[model samples]
Target: MSNTSNFRDAFRQAKTQALVGPNVIANALPYVGGGLVLTALGSYGGLGVLRTNPELFLPTFFGAIVLQLILFFVSQNVAEKGNNKVALPLLATYSLLTGYTLSGLIFVALKNQGVGIQGIGLAALGCGVTFIAARQIGSNLSEQDGMALTKTINLGVIALVAVLVVQLLFSAFGVYTPNWLEIAISGLGVFLFVGASVVDFYILPRTYKDDQYLPAALSMYLTYINLFVFILRLLIALNGRD
Candidate 1:
């Protein structure tokens, strides 16, 4: 009976740790961009990673996707072995690929013609503040889901899929709409992203255990990326108004 009780306590602690880990990671991810920018600056000055206009962004973009996918699978398999060492390298690799892919986005934002350094600075500041505030609040929040939570999460997933589909269609058709529309869409993306963070917050503790860091990191990374994208779009839209 003592052994059984200890086992249960261990499981509970692991779950709690998982819940906290991703939020910590998400908070740290914004800092990673700063690191990448420094690296880019050192290598190519302002024109390093973000300055080059490539007609073939798809190759690098898809390459990042492929790398992320590979890391996901590798992490999953390694996690099954109940060892975290196997997963850390995969996490590091994903982080590097993510940073590389984001260099293009940073470049595009700076070169948007409508957007200037002030606008970029404002957006970065806004996102950094939001990331810190949300993370702090999330760390203390406790989620005990009932039927309502289930329905909410399900709806969140559906909303996410619909938004993604529409975004893809618009991109495919080259449908350049009003800047307000883009901003509105970005606002919705932010809403969805925050919802996902809440869901992840609840999920990590319930579903994760030893060797779960990689999956947790991946989830937080996705949220970070989505948040960044929408924040950038909002900045661009605001700049367009000026």
Candidate 2:
């Protein structure tokens, strides 16, 4: 399961195969839905902690990041080996940690003018729409088209990660992305992930067996999470910074 920058690593682990699991995507949908719910719960819990003991947020947030990364690699290995029993809880925890990490940006979204709950809802809606559209578009793609799009999007995503790393380092030194640059970055993020959402549909069946639904679900979950983040960032950028 992969939906973010981690996807590149996951893809590198195995070469793509012929379509093996027609029902795998369907089977994975429930877990994907469940993961999103858990993520929301985790986000809510994070928000509560932020409100009650703001001082604790930074350390715990960083701790969560480290823990999530560890759990992610471990779970992906276990799941790839078909050890769902161990992997399920690990992935559950990973989702929660991811939501926890998202709290800071979500908090910012909550406070930004013209981009409160409504904007959050719109971001979510945007993912839903993208999913619906991607399913149709990606499913119908010819091999030539699919491969081309996948290559293009993956390259774009790698480039975006590089730019983001640079931006993060700059921010750490008291420099920040300019408003125009912020908008560009965020907008590109949304575009790339929308393309990614489509790529998942095309790639999953080709890559995973029916029993490998856990990884498939993980792939979809991270896509939506990233999509939501970028959409929220785009809205904030467009609406003016807080």
Candidate 3:
């Protein structure tokens, strides 16, 4: 499970972590931006691999995914404990691996005449817009409303994840999602992550004290990344095959 999932589970309880981290969300923002920059670099590197060594891409991508899973737990634990020195590099590596994993989707987006570079830019811009709106709306959410939305989005995410696993399994057997189904799945994903982005603004501060900004950054990073992925997917789905 990811660090974000752990925090999600933790927040399911009635109690919350004490407000130890004053201005924790603010502290986490710079790292979030830095991590995104690293992710962009990593994606560029992965694109190089895809262009020059296509056969190796799948193996390396899977390897990156497994390593990212391991690193997620380790880095989140260390960061939450306020061990910045140890956690920083680990989290940075984790972010890079995430970007590597993302490259496959990006590759598809890039190759399609419909999606191209412009679609990628739109996907990124969509995430930025979601962050801006989420910050505005989520920061103002009342506790009751926030919790309600969290529970709703959590359930949706669980269902969506299950669906994606099934879809991936089918894909391995040479079955593919129909265009309409892809559109539906991608649309739902975009909605859920946008909602999740909003929830992050509400929950992160309550869950992590200002000292624990790294974990907070991790959670937010995951949110934006997923949002970007789905927005790109939705774009591809709507545009259809080239």
lDDT of 2 by residue, 1-242 (tens): 23554566444533654677778889999999999988888899899889999999999999998898888888878887889999999999998998898888889999997899999999999999999999999888877787788788888888888899899899999998999999999999999999999988887777788999998888888888999999999999999888
lDDT of 1 by residue, 48-136 (tens): 53446455555766776687667656764574454657665665665566556556556667777776566556655665666576555
Best by lDDT: 2
Question: In angstroms, how far off is 102's CA in candidate 2?
Answer: 0.8
TM-score of 1: 0.65
Q: Against the correct fold, how does model 2 do in TM-score?
A: 0.95
Which segments of model 1 are wrong by more than 4 Å?
1-58, 117-124, 139-154
When sorted by lDDT, best at the front, the candidate numbers are 2, 3, 1
Candidate 3 has what TM-score? Answer: 0.94
* Candidate that scores best on TM-score: 2
lDDT of each: 0.54, 0.86, 0.85
lDDT of 3 by residue, 33-65 (tens): 999998998899899999999999999988998
Flag regions of model 3 displaced more than 4 Å.
1-7, 17-22
Which residue pairs collide in model 3, if any? 21-209, 21-210
Off by over 4 Å in 2: 1-6, 9-17
Model 1 lowest lDDT segment of ten = 1-10
lDDT comparing candidate 3 with the true structure: 0.85
